[model samples]
Target: MTTKTFLKAGLIGALFSAVAAHSALAFPANMTTDGPTNPPVGHYEFCRSLPQECGSNPGSAAPGVLTREGWKKILEVNYEINQAVTPMTDKEIYGVEEHWAYPDKVGDCEDYVLLKRKRLIETGFSPADLLITVVLQPNGDGHAVLTVRTDRGDFVLDNMRNKVLLWSETEYTYLKRQSEQNSGRWVKLQDGRTVAVGSVSQ
Candidate 1:
């Protein structure tokens, strides 16, 4: 074979190998879950106040299919909600701590999560795909984010940022999240981190 043809074939093979290696190291399509876990105090109370929002589904649940249009919608909702809601603690807003409810003008992290989940469901996303996840921030404080499970992977819609990122990409320690089979149930994440659960606030 000509030197030029041989060189071209060698470069193509190298490119394919590199791509394969990168794919192997890519983040998992789904986060691993352990046994059932206690729901966060705020989420428990929220379910009590709004039973309709936390009903259980009987059958198996599947992650939403992430298409170009769906991705665009997720971006829009994340950006809009983050921009619209001003962060405020429960003590400041409701004279108590750890309250989870839909926000009007201002709310804490969990509140932002709730609103985002609601909006996504209304926009044709499956309720099973929208999970309320509790995570431990870098400072050891508790925080919440909306975990959107799609065919591609689990992406986080955080109030702290408008950009949607994969669960593995975030710096926070994963704790637990709402069950895909049942919205009212909670499941512990396999993230091997132990720390005191601090008060959750924006």
Candidate 2:
């Protein structure tokens, strides 16, 4: 890997590490299933890998697939591909700067962040509004979090839980941020500061 890639990997060691640490990962009570059908898991099972289930069109949908409001409806249901399941207890999902406290979890922090970003784009939100953020959990280590800059302030879509929290309320030390700005545009926002971040359209 290139030097930059290596450094990023080193910094986000917690995010890229293996899966959940325990034998079984738990979701919030709201995430429970009465039978085979469930909210997050059912729709989530469709996209083992995003491109396969959702398609390669990162953020394009012809002319009339889904309206902005319709997209939000879709996002609320299957948050797993992009969101964190709300925790059952009061452990505090976003701990000190680590993507997750343990490795037993399944999806990577980036996976959750990207999934939510993709769904929002697919639905019709301005790509600029969604950012994949990096942070040091209060624990002060490298981790990833998705920050959604909405009309209602920045909200967090964490794999750690289903609760979408406000950005400042997230309580993590900002590190860097990347977002898909209108397809192919990426932004990197560093901690303690907000930068007009973007990458040229490829």
Candidate 3:
């Protein structure tokens, strides 16, 4: 192409690059996963039971914006799920290996998050917004909770609390969480962020 045409093309390409970079940066460094790994076994089981929830619902998540209604839904789902499921240690329920699944009669922390995510998806909430996050509690125990991504900020829906709180407000140290792009894979949160997995503390 002519010199003028080449320069125009270059300018357009640079503009697109900047937009992509900004979008990437929009995801807080704390939120991006360290890398992607296989989906947990319990998630596999959950998919077998509720195939629809596990399957891709394209464009299901909201536009990264948390509205007044979205906030209300978060609180409602957290309280309802927390009250519905009876908390029990994995050893008592499944024994060994972090078992993450949807809670029916009883489940551990991850199970609570799974159920919350399922119900929220059913309620027309985007699966992308509802992420399963793993964190180290203050007492040096590993814990699982639902991390809801919103325009307002990342909020946590924990089995430990009926009231939803910002992820930063919680006592847990950030570790890893499911990637928003794909539910089957998980990524580490930040470097040197680690915690122990104690039996269901909540």
Candidate 4:
């Protein structure tokens, strides 16, 4: 392998070893979905534009097992996309307040999530395992992230950070995410934080 690839493999191996050594200290295996919730307006519009991607897949509802290969792919995609995409809000890019779409080069948080989801799916991850999650930052600003459901736990890929962290490890308050059984539908998270309706921007 090339030097960069070799270094990446080493890093992933170290991460896997760390996770194995401290399995008991890991966060919850998954985030609990309370019930059906309203889809974010940006996601709704995204689904309307890409109906083929929003179809339900009941059989793949279960979280995918996070093998070493899967972990490597997740880390690579998260790091690459975060490096490749320049952060720009919808209002700055499309003259709108909230718009979600796959990023070409510059886009908002949701755009980063969408591109990460697409790339991971392309890398053989199940759509059900890759969720578009909405969250509230410590500052109360809305943000979006790609939540990868795996047997190890639910790891988040955020444009705000290149490191893949467990959902519980992040400081953001979980709000909702795309249903594993139905991409077009949403489910509330039992974060216990006050649910605030706000536009997700950079």
Candidate 5:
């Protein structure tokens, strides 16, 4: 890896080294189930926009083990995309129903997470480690964030914040997430342990 990559990894490692120590309070492993499903239309469009990644093979690494280089790549992609993209809803940007796609100028939460995941995958972070996760905001609005699984636990990369945080710190109720093995697939991520944060039923 290059010097930049090494520095990025070191930064991420320093920022998230505590996660693994606190993993017991994080989302339970049983919450996620496995299955291949259809990709959302906006994700489909985004995939069409980048055919190379859409057709690429999945990563073979064990789920959630954070290497210094991989962790740095995740932080780099998350921070870069969060700073670069202006947040706007699908209605404002596309003028229609909920659409999840990569943004050129402005896009909503889902769009932010999509681009982050795509970039991380492109940067050689395992697709299995990077997941697109959905949650119910405190106000009951449906929201999306990128979940980077690590030995430290699942850290959330949100458009609203530049820092990568454990999912428990985000104040959003866990709903569902993309399957580890495939980008096109999704799985429900709720268990009896989940705390309701909003009135939204998704």
Candidate 6:
């Protein structure tokens, strides 16, 4: 599935890691099997940073120019090279699935974003720019999206697709920025159609 495809329904229940056909995969490389690892405590502009507010600093999650190490960090994903994430896959991370339930090689979309955000912070991206965006696919399906604010603009990291794409490059309409609201929870988008959150649409 395309990045937007999986994201539209909070997918990523499975991860297909292939070096050739699906080289770009794995995503955040979360800390534990339970779920995504949270960012360091020092990073939060305040407990009220995400959804509750835009954060004290505007450019927190923005990873503009990555250093050599930082680039490596940003690119690092959860892949066991030479090991089969699946029997058919050759490389570490092949790709990801969103809607499929009980995804052995996958997880929820939130996990992907959490891992990505954590790794970026370790590399040097400010915690502010990385916004957790809940959006609907062009078809009005549910999903989650991570927006990495850059000096140029925002780059979207998705589990469904491999390479990162700009926000505009993807078709999913922006529903609500995780850091924009005070409740720190998912919100509906105006002017655009509505989609379910955390659930797949038939």
CA lDDT of each prediction against the hidden true structure: 0.78, 0.41, 0.66, 0.82, 0.68, 0.43
Full ranking by TM-score? 4, 1, 5, 3, 6, 2
lDDT of model 1 at residue 48?
93
Poorest 10 consecutive residues of model 1 by lDDT? Answer: 10-19
- Candidates sorted by lDDT, descending order? 4, 1, 5, 3, 6, 2
lDDT of 1: 0.78
Which candidate wins on lDDT? Answer: 4
Clashes (N, CA, C under 3 Å) per candidate: 0, 26, 5, 0, 1, 29
In candidate 3, which residue ranges exceed 4 Å CA deviation? 1-30, 38-41, 44-57, 60-63, 95-97, 191-202
Highest TM-score: give the candidate number.
Answer: 4
Task: Write one digit per residue (lDDT tens) for candidate 4, span 119-180.
Answer: 99999999999999989899888888999998777889999876788787789888889999
Model 1 steric clash pairs? none
TM-score of each: 0.83, 0.44, 0.70, 0.88, 0.75, 0.47
Q: Candidate 5 on 63-134: residue-level lDDT in tens? A: 656776676676677777877888887788888877766689798888888788778877777777777777
lDDT of 6 by residue, 68-186 (tens): 34333333432211111222221223353322121244445544555566556555677665666666777776566567655434557777665555564567765555442221323
Q: Which residues of candidate 6, in runs, are more than 4 Å off?
A: 1-73, 77-105, 180-202
What's the lDDT of the predicted structure labeled candidate 5?
A: 0.68
- The ten-residue window of minimal lDDT in model 6 covers 81-90
Better of 1 and 3 by lDDT: 1
Error of 5 at 142 (Å): 0.4
Q: How big is the positional error of residue 194 in model 2, measured in Å on the Cα after superposition?
A: 14
| Alpha-carbon RMSD, candidate 3 | 14.4
